[model samples]
Target: MAGHPLKKIQCESIARTSGKQCRAKGYLKKSGHYRCRFHGGASTGAITLEGKLIAYKNLKQFKNYTDEQLLIWIQNKLQKSSSV
Candidate 1:
Protein backbone atom coordinates (compact mmCIF):
# COMPACT_ATOMS: atom_id res chain seq x y z
CA MET A 1 0.00 0.00 0.00
CA ALA A 2 2.95 2.32 0.54
CA GLY A 3 4.27 1.74 -3.02
CA HIS A 4 2.86 2.15 -6.52
CA PRO A 5 -0.94 1.99 -6.69
CA LEU A 6 -0.74 -0.64 -9.41
CA LYS A 7 0.58 -3.10 -6.81
CA LYS A 8 -2.85 -3.07 -5.22
CA ILE A 9 -4.56 -4.23 -8.39
CA GLN A 10 -5.60 -7.86 -8.01
CA CYS A 11 -5.54 -10.33 -10.90
CA GLU A 12 -8.71 -10.47 -13.00
CA SER A 13 -8.41 -14.22 -13.37
CA ILE A 14 -10.21 -16.69 -11.11
CA ALA A 15 -8.75 -19.47 -8.96
CA ARG A 16 -9.24 -22.95 -10.38
CA THR A 17 -9.83 -24.71 -7.05
CA SER A 18 -11.46 -22.00 -4.93
CA GLY A 19 -13.65 -20.84 -7.81
CA LYS A 20 -12.95 -17.31 -6.60
CA GLN A 21 -10.94 -14.38 -7.89
CA CYS A 22 -7.15 -14.78 -7.68
CA ARG A 23 -5.43 -12.94 -4.81
CA ALA A 24 -2.12 -12.19 -6.53
CA LYS A 25 -1.26 -8.65 -7.58
CA GLY A 26 -1.60 -8.05 -11.32
CA TYR A 27 0.92 -6.70 -13.84
CA LEU A 28 0.07 -4.37 -16.70
CA LYS A 29 0.05 -5.91 -20.16
CA LYS A 30 0.71 -4.35 -23.61
CA SER A 31 -3.04 -4.38 -24.23
CA GLY A 32 -3.64 -2.22 -21.15
CA HIS A 33 -4.88 -5.10 -19.02
CA TYR A 34 -3.59 -6.32 -15.68
CA ARG A 35 -2.86 -10.02 -15.11
CA CYS A 36 -1.19 -11.97 -12.33
CA ARG A 37 1.97 -14.06 -12.69
CA PHE A 38 -0.01 -17.28 -12.56
CA HIS A 39 -2.48 -15.95 -15.06
CA GLY A 40 -1.82 -14.17 -18.37
CA GLY A 41 0.76 -11.82 -16.88
CA ALA A 42 3.82 -13.89 -17.91
CA SER A 43 6.21 -13.13 -20.77
CA THR A 44 4.77 -13.55 -24.28
CA GLY A 45 7.97 -15.20 -25.58
CA ALA A 46 10.52 -13.79 -28.04
CA ILE A 47 9.51 -10.87 -30.27
CA THR A 48 12.41 -9.81 -32.51
CA LEU A 49 13.60 -11.96 -35.44
CA GLU A 50 16.92 -12.85 -33.77
CA GLY A 51 15.13 -13.57 -30.51
CA LYS A 52 12.66 -15.81 -32.32
CA LEU A 53 15.51 -17.74 -33.96
CA ILE A 54 17.22 -18.21 -30.61
CA ALA A 55 14.00 -19.35 -29.03
CA TYR A 56 13.37 -21.76 -31.85
CA LYS A 57 16.88 -23.21 -31.48
CA ASN A 58 16.30 -23.66 -27.76
CA LEU A 59 13.34 -25.89 -28.60
CA LYS A 60 15.67 -28.41 -30.19
CA GLN A 61 17.05 -31.11 -27.88
CA PHE A 62 20.51 -30.69 -29.40
CA LYS A 63 21.46 -27.11 -30.14
CA ASN A 64 23.47 -26.23 -33.30
CA TYR A 65 22.63 -29.61 -34.78
CA THR A 66 22.10 -30.00 -38.50
CA ASP A 67 18.98 -31.72 -39.90
CA GLU A 68 20.94 -34.88 -40.75
CA GLN A 69 22.47 -34.97 -37.27
CA LEU A 70 19.04 -34.64 -35.66
CA LEU A 71 17.71 -37.40 -37.85
CA ILE A 72 20.64 -39.63 -36.89
CA TRP A 73 20.12 -38.85 -33.23
CA ILE A 74 16.45 -39.70 -33.44
CA GLN A 75 17.15 -42.94 -35.28
CA ASN A 76 19.77 -43.91 -32.70
CA LYS A 77 17.32 -43.19 -29.88
CA LEU A 78 14.64 -45.24 -31.58
CA GLN A 79 17.02 -48.14 -32.12
CA LYS A 80 18.17 -48.12 -28.49
CA SER A 81 14.56 -48.03 -27.22
CA SER A 82 13.53 -50.86 -29.54
CA SER A 83 16.48 -53.00 -28.39
CA VAL A 84 15.37 -52.61 -24.79
Candidate 2:
Protein backbone atom coordinates (compact mmCIF):
# COMPACT_ATOMS: atom_id res chain seq x y z
CA MET A 1 0.00 0.00 0.00
CA ALA A 2 1.17 3.53 -0.74
CA GLY A 3 1.21 6.36 1.79
CA HIS A 4 -0.97 9.47 1.34
CA PRO A 5 0.70 11.79 -1.19
CA LEU A 6 -0.09 14.82 1.00
CA LYS A 7 2.05 13.31 3.79
CA LYS A 8 5.11 14.32 1.83
CA ILE A 9 4.58 18.02 2.65
CA GLN A 10 5.44 18.35 6.33
CA CYS A 11 4.78 21.64 8.14
CA GLU A 12 7.77 23.98 7.93
CA SER A 13 6.83 25.89 11.06
CA ILE A 14 8.87 25.51 14.24
CA ALA A 15 7.13 24.58 17.47
CA ARG A 16 7.14 27.35 20.10
CA THR A 17 7.68 24.99 23.03
CA SER A 18 10.05 22.36 21.61
CA GLY A 19 11.65 24.76 19.11
CA LYS A 20 11.72 22.03 16.50
CA GLN A 21 10.19 21.72 13.07
CA CYS A 22 6.51 20.71 13.23
CA ARG A 23 5.99 17.15 11.95
CA ALA A 24 2.33 17.50 10.95
CA LYS A 25 1.20 17.49 7.36
CA GLY A 26 0.81 21.01 5.92
CA TYR A 27 -1.86 22.43 3.64
CA LEU A 28 -0.85 24.68 0.79
CA LYS A 29 -2.18 28.22 1.15
CA LYS A 30 -3.08 30.94 -1.36
CA SER A 31 -0.10 32.89 -0.05
CA GLY A 32 2.20 30.09 -1.16
CA HIS A 33 2.89 29.04 2.42
CA TYR A 34 2.45 25.65 4.04
CA ARG A 35 1.01 25.43 7.55
CA CYS A 36 -0.58 22.68 9.56
CA ARG A 37 -4.01 23.13 11.18
CA PHE A 38 -2.31 23.63 14.55
CA HIS A 39 -0.14 26.41 13.16
CA GLY A 40 -2.68 28.83 11.67
CA GLY A 41 -3.47 26.87 8.54
CA ALA A 42 -6.90 28.51 8.44
CA SER A 43 -6.23 31.88 10.04
CA THR A 44 -7.22 34.81 7.86
CA GLY A 45 -6.76 37.35 10.67
CA ALA A 46 -9.06 40.28 11.57
CA ILE A 47 -10.25 41.92 8.36
CA THR A 48 -12.66 44.53 9.65
CA LEU A 49 -12.25 47.49 12.03
CA GLU A 50 -14.49 45.89 14.64
CA GLY A 51 -12.70 42.59 14.22
CA LYS A 52 -9.32 44.29 14.57
CA LEU A 53 -10.45 46.10 17.71
CA ILE A 54 -11.68 42.84 19.21
CA ALA A 55 -8.47 41.11 18.32
CA TYR A 56 -6.41 43.95 19.82
CA LYS A 57 -8.40 43.90 23.04
CA ASN A 58 -7.91 40.15 23.33
CA LEU A 59 -4.13 40.36 22.98
CA LYS A 60 -2.11 38.73 25.77
CA GLN A 61 -0.37 42.02 26.58
CA PHE A 62 -3.59 43.99 27.10
CA LYS A 63 -2.86 44.16 30.82
CA ASN A 64 0.07 46.48 30.15
CA TYR A 65 -2.20 49.27 28.85
CA THR A 66 -4.69 51.33 30.83
CA ASP A 67 -8.30 51.71 29.72
CA GLU A 68 -7.61 55.28 28.54
CA GLN A 69 -4.58 54.13 26.61
CA LEU A 70 -6.57 51.35 25.00
CA LEU A 71 -9.28 53.82 24.04
CA ILE A 72 -6.68 56.09 22.50
CA TRP A 73 -5.30 53.19 20.49
CA ILE A 74 -8.75 52.25 19.32
CA GLN A 75 -9.49 55.84 18.31
CA ASN A 76 -6.26 55.95 16.33
CA LYS A 77 -7.14 52.72 14.57
CA LEU A 78 -10.58 54.10 13.76
CA GLN A 79 -9.03 57.21 12.30
CA LYS A 80 -6.75 55.16 10.10
CA SER A 81 -9.61 53.04 8.91
CA SER A 82 -11.67 56.10 8.06
CA SER A 83 -8.78 57.62 6.16
CA VAL A 84 -8.37 54.48 4.14
Candidate 3:
Protein backbone atom coordinates (compact mmCIF):
# COMPACT_ATOMS: atom_id res chain seq x y z
CA MET A 1 0.00 0.00 0.00
CA ALA A 2 3.02 2.24 -0.21
CA GLY A 3 1.92 4.00 -3.34
CA HIS A 4 -1.73 4.14 -2.41
CA PRO A 5 -2.92 7.74 -2.03
CA LEU A 6 -5.60 6.82 0.49
CA LYS A 7 -3.10 5.38 2.96
CA LYS A 8 -1.05 8.56 3.08
CA ILE A 9 -2.76 9.85 6.21
CA GLN A 10 -2.06 6.64 8.09
CA CYS A 11 1.60 6.81 7.14
CA GLU A 12 1.86 10.46 8.10
CA SER A 13 0.12 9.97 11.44
CA ILE A 14 2.38 7.05 12.31
CA ALA A 15 5.44 9.07 11.44
CA ARG A 16 4.20 12.02 13.45
CA THR A 17 3.44 10.00 16.56
CA SER A 18 6.25 7.42 16.40
CA GLY A 19 9.08 9.78 15.38
CA LYS A 20 9.95 7.30 12.64
CA GLN A 21 8.33 7.18 9.23
CA CYS A 22 6.60 3.90 8.43
CA ARG A 23 4.86 2.40 5.44
CA ALA A 24 2.81 -0.19 7.27
CA LYS A 25 -0.98 0.15 6.90
CA GLY A 26 -4.19 -1.34 8.17
CA TYR A 27 -7.91 -0.85 7.79
CA LEU A 28 -9.35 2.09 9.66
CA LYS A 29 -11.49 0.58 12.51
CA LYS A 30 -14.53 0.90 10.28
CA SER A 31 -13.79 1.61 6.64
CA GLY A 32 -12.37 4.91 5.46
CA HIS A 33 -10.04 6.20 8.19
CA TYR A 34 -6.62 4.63 8.54
CA ARG A 35 -4.02 4.33 11.32
CA CYS A 36 -0.91 2.36 12.21
CA ARG A 37 -0.97 -0.25 14.97
CA PHE A 38 0.68 2.11 17.47
CA HIS A 39 -2.22 4.53 17.30
CA GLY A 40 -5.04 2.21 16.38
CA GLY A 41 -6.82 0.83 19.40
CA ALA A 42 -10.56 1.37 19.52
CA SER A 43 -10.30 4.99 18.39
CA THR A 44 -13.56 6.92 18.14
CA GLY A 45 -12.54 9.87 16.02
CA ALA A 46 -9.80 12.34 15.13
CA ILE A 47 -10.22 16.03 15.96
CA THR A 48 -8.55 19.30 15.22
CA LEU A 49 -6.69 21.23 17.93
CA GLU A 50 -9.86 23.21 18.70
CA GLY A 51 -11.88 19.96 18.89
CA LYS A 52 -13.79 19.19 15.75
CA LEU A 53 -14.62 15.82 14.22
CA ILE A 54 -12.35 15.58 11.23
CA ALA A 55 -13.06 11.97 10.30
CA TYR A 56 -14.72 8.92 11.78
CA LYS A 57 -15.91 5.65 10.29
CA ASN A 58 -16.85 4.04 13.58
CA LEU A 59 -16.77 4.80 17.31
CA LYS A 60 -13.52 2.86 17.56
CA GLN A 61 -11.88 5.14 15.02
CA PHE A 62 -11.16 7.89 17.53
CA LYS A 63 -8.88 8.12 20.52
CA ASN A 64 -10.81 10.92 22.19
CA TYR A 65 -14.56 11.15 21.88
CA THR A 66 -17.17 12.95 23.95
CA ASP A 67 -17.84 11.48 27.40
CA GLU A 68 -21.28 10.22 26.44
CA GLN A 69 -20.09 8.68 23.20
CA LEU A 70 -17.07 7.09 24.82
CA LEU A 71 -19.13 5.55 27.59
CA ILE A 72 -21.63 4.07 25.18
CA TRP A 73 -19.11 2.72 22.69
CA ILE A 74 -16.79 1.36 25.34
CA GLN A 75 -19.60 -0.43 27.05
CA ASN A 76 -20.87 -1.86 23.81
CA LYS A 77 -17.52 -3.00 22.48
CA LEU A 78 -16.52 -4.47 25.82
CA GLN A 79 -19.75 -6.39 26.04
CA LYS A 80 -19.44 -7.63 22.48
CA SER A 81 -15.80 -8.61 22.87
CA SER A 82 -16.52 -10.48 26.07
CA SER A 83 -19.41 -12.32 24.50
CA VAL A 84 -17.22 -13.41 21.63
Candidate 4:
Protein backbone atom coordinates (compact mmCIF):
# COMPACT_ATOMS: atom_id res chain seq x y z
CA MET A 1 0.00 0.00 0.00
CA ALA A 2 1.18 3.56 -0.85
CA GLY A 3 4.30 5.16 0.57
CA HIS A 4 2.66 6.22 3.82
CA PRO A 5 3.67 4.19 6.83
CA LEU A 6 1.08 2.07 8.64
CA LYS A 7 0.09 3.02 12.15
CA LYS A 8 2.06 1.20 14.82
CA ILE A 9 -0.99 0.55 16.94
CA GLN A 10 -4.58 -0.52 16.34
CA CYS A 11 -7.85 -0.93 18.24
CA GLU A 12 -10.26 -3.87 18.14
CA SER A 13 -13.86 -4.46 19.21
CA ILE A 14 -16.73 -6.80 18.59
CA ALA A 15 -20.00 -5.59 17.10
CA ARG A 16 -22.69 -6.40 19.63
CA THR A 17 -25.27 -6.86 16.92
CA SER A 18 -23.31 -8.78 14.35
CA GLY A 19 -20.81 -10.44 16.67
CA LYS A 20 -18.15 -9.74 14.07
CA GLN A 21 -14.84 -8.63 15.51
CA CYS A 22 -13.97 -5.21 14.19
CA ARG A 23 -10.47 -3.90 13.98
CA ALA A 24 -9.42 -0.40 12.90
CA LYS A 25 -6.14 0.20 11.20
CA GLY A 26 -4.72 3.61 10.35
CA TYR A 27 -3.62 4.20 6.77
CA LEU A 28 -2.74 6.92 4.29
CA LYS A 29 -5.13 8.86 2.04
CA LYS A 30 -4.08 6.73 -0.91
CA SER A 31 -5.32 3.55 0.83
CA GLY A 32 -8.42 2.53 -1.11
CA HIS A 33 -10.61 0.70 1.44
CA TYR A 34 -10.55 1.12 5.24
CA ARG A 35 -10.33 -2.33 6.84
CA CYS A 36 -8.65 -4.39 9.48
CA ARG A 37 -5.27 -5.95 8.96
CA PHE A 38 -6.68 -9.47 8.63
CA HIS A 39 -9.68 -9.20 6.33
CA GLY A 40 -9.20 -6.28 3.95
CA GLY A 41 -5.92 -4.78 2.82
CA ALA A 42 -6.29 -1.24 4.20
CA SER A 43 -8.56 1.24 5.88
CA THR A 44 -10.35 4.52 5.02
CA GLY A 45 -12.09 5.36 8.34
CA ALA A 46 -10.00 6.95 11.06
CA ILE A 47 -10.57 5.91 14.66
CA THR A 48 -9.44 7.79 17.74
CA LEU A 49 -7.85 6.24 20.82
CA GLU A 50 -11.14 6.61 22.64
CA GLY A 51 -12.95 4.94 19.75
CA LYS A 52 -14.56 7.96 18.16
CA LEU A 53 -15.21 8.02 14.45
CA ILE A 54 -13.27 10.87 12.91
CA ALA A 55 -13.67 11.61 9.23
CA TYR A 56 -11.05 10.09 6.96
CA LYS A 57 -10.37 13.53 5.44
CA ASN A 58 -9.81 15.01 8.88
CA LEU A 59 -7.36 12.20 9.62
CA LYS A 60 -5.30 13.21 6.57
CA GLN A 61 -5.35 16.85 7.70
CA PHE A 62 -3.93 15.92 11.09
CA LYS A 63 -1.59 13.22 9.87
CA ASN A 64 1.34 15.36 10.86
CA TYR A 65 0.18 15.70 14.47
CA THR A 66 2.15 13.79 17.08
CA ASP A 67 0.75 10.58 18.55
CA GLU A 68 0.38 12.30 21.93
CA GLN A 69 -1.75 15.02 20.37
CA LEU A 70 -3.96 12.44 18.69
CA LEU A 71 -4.31 10.52 21.93
CA ILE A 72 -5.30 13.68 23.80
CA TRP A 73 -7.89 14.49 21.16
CA ILE A 74 -9.32 11.02 21.54
CA GLN A 75 -9.39 11.34 25.32
CA ASN A 76 -11.27 14.62 25.05
CA LYS A 77 -13.88 12.96 22.87
CA LEU A 78 -14.20 10.09 25.33
CA GLN A 79 -14.67 12.51 28.22
CA LYS A 80 -17.76 13.85 26.50
CA SER A 81 -19.36 10.44 26.34
CA SER A 82 -22.10 9.46 28.77
CA SER A 83 -20.94 7.43 31.76
CA VAL A 84 -21.87 3.80 31.42
TM-scores for all candidates? 0.55, 0.45, 0.26, 0.30
Worst 10 residues of 1 by lDDT: 48-57
Compute the lDDT for candidate 1. 0.71
RMSD after Cα superposition, model 4: 14.3
Q: Write the per-residue lDDT of candidate 3 for residues 21-76, one digit (tens) a residue.
A: 56666546664556667656665544342233323324466666775665565568
Off by over 4 Å in 2: 1-7, 45-84
Candidate 3 stretches with Cα past 4 Å from truth are: 1-14, 17-21, 43-84
What shift in Å separates residue 37 of candidate 1 from its native position after superposition?
Answer: 0.9
Q: Tens-digit lDDT track for model 4 on 1-84? A: 544346433334455668865645533334453445564545544454434434422577677766667767666756787454
Angstrom error at residue 3, model 2: 4.3
**For candidate 2, lDDT tens digit of each residue in 1-84?**
257865479778999999999988788877787888898548768777567667787788876876667778888867898999
lDDT against the true structure, each candidate: 0.71, 0.78, 0.56, 0.52
Q: Pairing residues by index, what is the TM-score of model 3? A: 0.26
lDDT of 2 at 62: 79
User: Could you arrange the candidates by lDDT from highest to lowest?
Assistant: 2, 1, 3, 4
For model 4, state the Cα shift of residue 69 in Å.
Answer: 0.4
Best-matching candidate per TM-score = 1
